[model samples]
Target: MRAALPGARTRPSARARRERTAGLAFISPWIFGFLVFTAWPILYSGYLSLTDYDVLTDPSFVGLDNYERMVGDPQVRLALWNTLQYTLLQVPLYVLVALALALLLHQAGRASGFFRTAFFVPKMTPPVAVGVLLLLLFNGEYGLVNEALGAVGIDGPSWTTDPDWIRPGLALVSLWSVGAAVVILLAALQDVPVELYDAARVDGAGWWRRTRTVTIPMISGALFFVTVVNTIAAFQMFTEAYSAYFGAGNSTYSNDAALFYVIYLFREGFAELHMGYASALAWLLFVVIMLVTAVQLLVSRRLVYYEGEQR
Candidate 1:
């Protein structure tokens, strides 16, 4: 080949440069926010996890001490077990209730919009407000839930007070927020081709058969989306539990049963001023969530159906 020309550099035109600058300028806020608020904090926390930092003092290096202590911390184990129980109870029930509600709303025809909005109203309610409402309804005496149960000659359990019933109470609280999942599933249901259901019916499939064979497979992507989202939310459960049992840092009436993992982390970090230890807890939780999500994705490979994929 001939030798290259000395002045053969090709730079972007002024218009192209201007367009690129404008695009970068438009996204600069998001970039800055992510770097400052999300990425930096994550990295800082990871560093802090290896130190013995109280907020009042500088972080002094303490390699693996926090991680070692975590293994023997009874409170951490309690919190983990409680959180696991809550997740186990909440996720499946939430999905089932959401799917059922979506199915009912889908069949409502003229009343569909009204019913959907009504169901979603509970989700729009603030978590604090929901906590208050739950306390009022589940109070030991003169609560509406007990009153209804009494009317049927069945005494309702003391939901908020009894440790045995605390997880169930929290489960009920979670069920109230299933409206968002229902709305998502409803949207997915609408997108599914009616012709598929019609074809299933023509092939002598009944309602259950149609749902299992057509509706489920068609909406599996949205189902998987909701499952993954709710799984993450369940793992990071804090606000509702805090508002319900330990608002304003008051741990009164909060039993070990209700001590969720994040609540324990909050107590250690802010209340006890063990910021470094709390950072370690946060990182551990992050790892748990990642592992759980990975397992789910692996399982979903066998279950979740994407459109246009070969059999």
Candidate 2:
């Protein structure tokens, strides 16, 4: 049976080798783009974080000055708090809503394509439009939201006003464009083997158990991916806040209610021309995101079960 043919297993056919080469060659462009655009800036920013680089002047060595200021700067602390608040409040809301939507579409067993497209429509909308729409919806004076509240015998607060309600406004704005997340979770749900659900049912497991024992484990990777990605987005929240309240360069619109870490970094970096401080802000964000992700990974290992891993 061995070596029956002279050239058996001698070489991959020309087309097969070409296909492999072509695949690698095709992806090389993306690899180049990532290194040039992403890797360079990250490395550059880290270097700048250690120096005072005002665009007007050559970068002056500042050795830990930016980091020290970041620790003491009141606005830095405030921005960090705001970013964390966004992560805690919005990530859960977005991920849970996405999961719920994914599960609903998954269980519908019909019209899934329709529901998926419907849910994904929001992500396609321009962020500017979303900000304007939310502004109109949550506006206090003669806005649709206040009008609705008035009809229900309640008055809505001035959304862009009222420090206490500002975060809520941000969170509300966060929910509008979660279509990307929904699409992701939907894909994950699609891969959940239906046989597991049937087996759980046959074993007298209730809905909760089905989710815990079947759905969650199977989709845990997607969950982690969405969580980390959403957390990073939340930490970098700027568009909603900037467009709605603090446009181009009028400073922060309100009592810095919408002051996010990235927004602050932008102001400190470009507007105020504190390049070193802004770089410090960026690096602090990197550290915080890393720490938060590490913590989540640690905790998730306890709860995020992967399929076939013994409980």
Error of 2 at 45 (Å): 1.8
The positional error of residue 231 in candidate 2, measured at the CA in angstroms, is 0.9
lDDT of 1 by residue, 1-311 (tens): 67758989767999999999999999999999999999999999999999999999999999999999999999999999999998998888889999999999999998989988888888888888887777888776888888998999998998887888888888877888888998999999999998998898889999999999999988999999999999999988887778878876446565677899999999999999999999999999999999999999999998999989988
lDDT (tens digit, per residue) of candidate 2 on 11-120 = 68899999999999999999899999999999988888899888899898889989888777899878878777767888888889888888888877779888788878
Candidate 2 lDDT at 178 equals: 77
Candidate 2: 10-residue stretch with minimal lDDT: 247-256
* TM-score of every prediction relative to native: 0.91, 0.85
Q: What is the lDDT of residue 276 in candidate 1?
A: 99
Candidate 1 structure, TM-score to reference: 0.91
For model 1, the stretches where C-alpha displacement exceeds 4 angstroms are 1-22, 248-254
